[model samples]
Structure formats: C-alpha cells, structure tokens
Target: MDLTVKIKRYNPEKDDAPHWESYEVPADPLDSALALLLHVKWHIDGTLSLRKSCAHGICGSDAMQINGENKLACSVLVKDLVDDSGETVTFAPLPSAPVIKDLVIDQSRFFEKYRSVKPWLINDTPEPERERPQSPEEHEIIEDATKCIMCGACTHACPSTWADPDYLGPAAMLKAYRYTFDTRDDGTEERLDIVDSPDGLWKCYTIFNCNQACPKEIDITRWLSALKRRAVTSSASTAA
Candidate 1:
C-alpha cells in the first residue's frame, strides 16, 4: 500500500521555523511508523535526523508526536494511522522539549528531572545478611510503576510539564510513587518533600494525558492520586 507520511522538518542553520514535508511511502499493513521514517530518511531526505535504538517499542527512543499524541513510532502501525482519503501520519518532536533537529529532541531536561527523583530505592538501614524479606502482596503495589522505561512519552504529553518545564513530569512522579508504595522503602516521607511543592506534585492538573500516552499501560493518574492521598495523610499524621 502507498502511505503518505507528513513530517515536520527543522534545521537551525537554514530554517527559522519547522515546515511540513510529505513523502509517499510504500508500506504494508504491518509497517510501523519507525519503518516509514527510515524509508523517508533513506530515500526522501538524507538530512533527516531522529533517534532509534531498538526497532521494538521497549527502548522508548523513538517516542515522538504522531497526530498530536506522544507515541512510540515502532509501536504504531501505519495502516491504522492513515485515513481513507490517503491522509498521511503527521510527525513532530515531543512537546515541552528542545528539538535538536527533525524529530530528535534534547533529552537533557528529561534526564535531569529523572535524576531529581532519586529513582532508586533507598533504605536507611543496612541490607539484611540475605535478601530482604518481602511478600507478593507488598511487591504488587509497586509493580506497575516499575514498568516505566523512562520513555518521556507521559511527560511530553503532560499539560503541567508543558506549562512548567521545571515540573518533575509524569515519569518521575510515577517513579516517586513506585518507591512511595514500596513496603521496604523508608524514604517516602523524604521523597514526598521533593514532589510536595509547586513544581512537584502540586503542578499536576490531572489531565490524564500521561496515562493515555503510556505504552506500558501504567495507570499514572491512579498512582498520582494515591501519592496525593498519602502526602496529605502523612502531613496530618506528622502534625498530630
């Protein structure tokens, strides 16, 4: 099948703003968005630049704006995207981040926010002589949050992140909840401090775009709700 892929191209050296460039790509029902991009790069525009590590959806490197939503290029099929009128898939860099070139975004701010969360579990006490004892019930609470691949899809789709770039964003907040829910983690109170202020959890507007954008199917809103509840109760309990 022939598919038209309309991509937004930008070059700091040449263009003042991004421009749309469409290409008719030979695609099958099984063709992925990433495959279409590769075809365009190889044939249409040799100057096109983007990021792709694994052709699979797991790497999160190919996350970009497709038809106004953040999604993994490898995960979205071209057949499902195109309309009956032969309208093409629209491609652009993820929102709220600086575009380095045509679909590639500067990830330094994303990574910096991730680091601010102190994503790893921190136990004040020393490790047990053997593995720390834990039950399946205890592990289950944090299981979904751990599925985050740091894709930045959720963050890019988040309205709060777009309004305030300093906001920790959904990915980091989900990571915060992962540890907050962990029975073994004793740092929840301290971690809450990091996300308690304006640029932290309070910035969230509950748009639910993060949950919608998550390829892992993680319930970011539910977890964020839980974190908010915990934060409130913890503060009350501490005051008492």
Candidate 2:
C-alpha cells in the first residue's frame, strides 16, 4: 500500500516556528508507524529526526500525536490508519511540550513531574534480611499502573496539563498511585502530601483523555480516581 506521512518539523536554529513536511512511502499495511518513520529517515530524508530505543513499543521514546491522538508509533499499524478516507497519517510531537526537532519533544519537564512522585520503592524502616515480598493479589492491585513507560502520552493528552503546565498530570498521579497503593511501600503519607496539592491531583477533572491516549491500555482515569479517594480517606483518618 502507498502511505503519505505528514510530520510537524521544528529546527530551533533555523525555523522560527514548526512546519509541516510530508513523505510518500510504499509500505505494507502490516508495517508499524515507527517502521514507516524509519523508512523515511533511512531512504527518503536522513535529516528527519525521531527517538526510538526499541521499536517494539518497550521504550516509549517514540511517542507522538498521531491522527490527533497520542500514541506509540510502534503500536500503531498502517492498516488501521489507512482507511478509505485517505492513506495519510499525521504525526506531531507530544502536545504541551517544547518541540526539539522533528517528532521529538523535550521530555525533561515530563520526567521532572514523574520523578516528583517518587516512583521507586520507599520503604525506609530498615533493610530486610530478604527482599520484601508481595503476594499476587497485592501486586495485582497496582499491576496496571506499573505498566507505565513514562511515554508522556497521558500527560500530553491531558487538558489540565495544557491549560496549566504546572498542573501535575495523569502520568505522575498514576506513579503516585503505583506506590501509594502498594502494600510494600511505606511512604504513602509523604507521597499523598504532594499528590493532594491544588496543582496536583485536584487539577485532573477526570476528562479521560489520558485513558484514550495510553498505549498500554491502562485505566489511567480510574487509577487517578482511586488516588483521589485515597487522599480523602487518608486525610480523614488523620483528622479523626
């Protein structure tokens, strides 16, 4: 099948603003969008820039806004995008972030918000003689949230993040939930303090855009709601 890929390009030193560039590719319908991008970079235009650590969708580095939705290029197939309407697929850097070059957006701010949630285990009581163990049931509670690859798709798709960049977006809140709900974690109170702030959890209006953009099929809005309830419940018990 023949596919036309439209990319939004930006060169900080050259163009004052981003612009559109298109490429015509003869490709298999089974080809991934990332595969198409690689084809363009390799054969069509060497200057075309994108980030892809693992084209299998593990790194989530190639996350971009495709057809007006944030998605991992590797997870999106050409056949799905190529309908009778047109065999054209539009690509842009993740929204609400500075464009670096072509399809790459500056993810520094995205990671900053992610780190603020303390995504790692926070048990500071003491080092156990053996690794702290968890049952399948306990791990399953947070299993979905743990699937996050920090793609920033959820955060970029979020209206709250767009309205106010300072707002702690869904990705971070999901990180908060990942550990806060983990029975092995001991920093629930500390993490909740950060998550309960005005610009943090409250900023999310439960729009569910994050849910749709997530490539992992994670129920992000649902997990965020669970975090909200957790904060309220934690605060109430403290008051009592």
Candidate 3:
C-alpha cells in the first residue's frame, strides 16, 4: 500500500517558517513510520533530518508529533494511523520546544528539567558490597516509571510545561516519583522539596495529556497525582 506522509518541515538557514511537505511512499501496513522516514531520507531527500537510533522503540530517540499526538515514530505502525476515509499520516517535531530542523526539536531544555529532579538513587548510607536489595512489591511501585527512556513525549504534551517554560514537566516529575517512592532510597524530603515548588509538581493540572502522549502506555497522570499527594502529605507532616 502507498501511504501519504505529510511532515512539518523547517530549516533555520533556508526557511523563514516551518512548512508542510508530503511524500508518497509504498509501504506495508506493518511497516513503522521510522521505516518510511528512512526511505524518504535515503531516496527522496537526503536533506531530511530526524533523530533515530535502534529503530526498535527502546531508544526513545524518534519521538515526534504523529497524527496530532506525541509518539515514537519507530513504534507506531502504519496501519494504526489509517482510517476508513483518511489516508494521510502527519509528522511534526514534539511540541512545546523549539524546532532545530526538519522533524527535530531542541531537547536540551527537556533534559535540563530531567536533571533538575535528580533522577538517580539518593541513598547516603555506606555502599553495600552487593547490590542494594528491594522487595518485589517495592520494585513494582516504580516498575512503570522505570520503563521511561526519557523520550520527552510526556513532557512535550503537557500544557503546563507549554505555558511555563520553567515548569519541571511530567518527565521530571515522574522521575521524582520513582526515586521518592523507592523503599531503598532516602531522599524523599529533598526530592519533595524540589517538586513542591511553584514551578514544579504543583503546576500540573491533571489534564491527562501526558497520559495520552506517552507511547510506553504508562499511566503518567496517575503517578503524577500520586506525587502530588505525597508532596501534600510531606508538607503537612513537616508543619506538624
């Protein structure tokens, strides 16, 4: 089958503004959007630039706005986008960030927000000779969050992050939730302090855009609400 791919394109040195560019490419319904893009880059236009690695959905390097939602191009199948009457597939760089080129957005700010949350373990105790142990139940609490490859989809989908560039978006907040809730970690107080601020977890309005945008299918909104509750409880106890 032939698929019509419409990509939102931009080039800083050549284009005054981003524009739509389309290509008709033959593909299997089971073929990935990344495969189609690769075809275009290799055959149609060598100047087309987009980030992709592994091409297997694990790297999260190919996140893009597809069919008006944030998704990893490598994971979304061609058939999943086809409708009864609609035959067009649209690709744009992830929203809420500056576009660097054709279908690529600047992600430096996204990673900076991620680091602000301190995603690593924070146990200050002497290092154990063996790996620190965590119960199965405890590990399950963070299993979904651990699945995050820092794709920036959830963050780009967030309205709060769009409204306030300073807001430490869902990706960072989810990381905070993962570390703050870990039974083996002891950084809850510090992590909560960082997220409970004006531009932190409180900025989230529970709109659930992050839930819809996450290609991993992790219930980011639910976990974020969990973080909000944890923050509130921590504040109450600290006051008492």
Candidate 4:
C-alpha cells in the first residue's frame, strides 16, 4: 500500500526553524513506522536523519512522537497508525528536548535525570564471598520497575518536565522507586531525600501521561504514587 509519511524536519546548520516534509512510500501494512522511515531514507531522501541501533525496540533509541503520542517507531506498525481510509502518519521529535535533526531529540537531559537518582544497586553492607542473595518475593517487588528501558517516552510525555526542565520526571522517579523498594538496597533514605525536593517527585502532579506513554506497559503512575506515599511517611516520621 502507498502511504504518506510526514516528518517534522530540522537542520540546525541550514534551517533557522523546523519544517514539515512529506514522503510517499510503498509500504506493507505490516511494516513498522521505522521500516517506512528506512524506506524513505534509503530510496527517497538520503539526507533524512534519525537514530536507531537495535531495531527490535530493546535499545529504545527510536522513540519519537507518532500521531501526537510518544512511542517507539520500531514497535508501532503502520497499520495501527492508519485509519479506516488510511490517512497519513505523522512523526515528530520528542517534545521538551532539543531536536538535533529530523526525528531525533537530544537525550543528554534524560540521561542526566536518570543518573541523578543513581539507578544502581548501592549496598554498604559487607560483602560475603558470594553474590548477595534476594528472595523471590523481594525480586518480584522491583521486577516491573526494572523493566524500564530508560526510553524518554514517559519523560517526554510528562507536562511537568516540559514546564520545568529541572523536574526529575517519571523515569527518574521510577528508578528511585525501583531501588527504594529493593530489599538489598540500603540507599532508601538518601534516595528519598533526593526526590523530596521541589523539582523531584512532588512535581509530578499525578497527570498520568507518563503511565499512558510507557511503551513497556509499566504502570509508572502506580510507582510514583508509592514513592509519594513513602516520601510523605518518611517526612512525618522525621518530624516526629
């Protein structure tokens, strides 16, 4: 089937502002949006730019705004994007971040936020001869949180982060929750303090955009709610 793919294009060196460019490509209905993009890049326009490593969606590098929603281009089928009459599919760079080129946004801010929460296992306890052991129950608690691929979908979908770039956003807060709930991690107190600030978990406003935008199907709102509760309880205990 012939489909029109509209992409928002921007070249910092050439264009003063962004503009829209449309391409008509012969694409299979079963083909992914990324596939259509590849067709355009290979056949139509070699100058078109985007980012993708593992096209299977594990790398989360192809995240972009598709039909006004943040999602992985490799995972979204072209059929799903078309209506009954098969209208055109639109693609744009992730919002709230600097766009480097067509369909690509700078991820430096996203990674900085992720790093702020220290998304790693931190245990000051003395190490035994063998690796630390965790019960099945403990592992299950953080299993869903650990599924996060650090894709900027949730973060870009967040209005708070868009309004205030300093806000920690859902992805970082989710990472904070992941470690805070881990049985082996001993950095809960420190993590809580980091997220208790104005630009942290409290800024979420419970909009639920992060939850809706998560491609991994992870319930990010639930994790943020849990983090909020933990922060409140910790605050109350500290005051008392």
Give lDDT for model 4. Answer: 0.90
How well does model 1 score by local distance difference test?
0.88
Estimate the Cα RMSD of every predicted model relative to the unseen true structure: 1.4, 1.0, 1.1, 1.1
Which ten residues in a row are the worst by lDDT in model 1?
79-88
What does candidate 2's lDDT look like per residue over 1-240, in tens digits? 888889998888899999999999889988898898899999999998899998887888989998888999999988888764388888899998988898888888888888898988998788889989999999999999999998889999999999999898999999999999999999999999999997899988999999999999999999999999999999999999
lDDT, residue 207, candidate 2: 98
Runs in model 4 deviating more than 4 A are none
Clashes of each: 0, 0, 0, 0
Which window of ten consecutive residues has the lowest lDDT sum in model 3? 80-89
lDDT tens readout by residue for model 1, 1-240 = 887788999998899998999898888878888999999999988899999999888888999998878999998887777754356788999987998899999999989988887788889798889987779999998889888888899999998888889999999889999988888888888899898888999788888999999988899999998999999998999999
lDDT of 2: 0.91
lDDT of each candidate versus the true structure? 0.88, 0.91, 0.91, 0.90
lDDT of 3 by residue, 1-240 (tens): 888888899999999999999999888889998988998899899999999998888999999998898999999898888764378888999987999999888999999988888889999899999989999999999999889988999999999988998999999999999999899989999998899899998889999999898889889989999999998888898899
**Per-residue lDDT for 155-202 in model 4, tens only?**
999999899998999999999999999998999889998999989988
Off by over 4 Å in 3: none
Model 3 scores a C-alpha lDDT of: 0.91
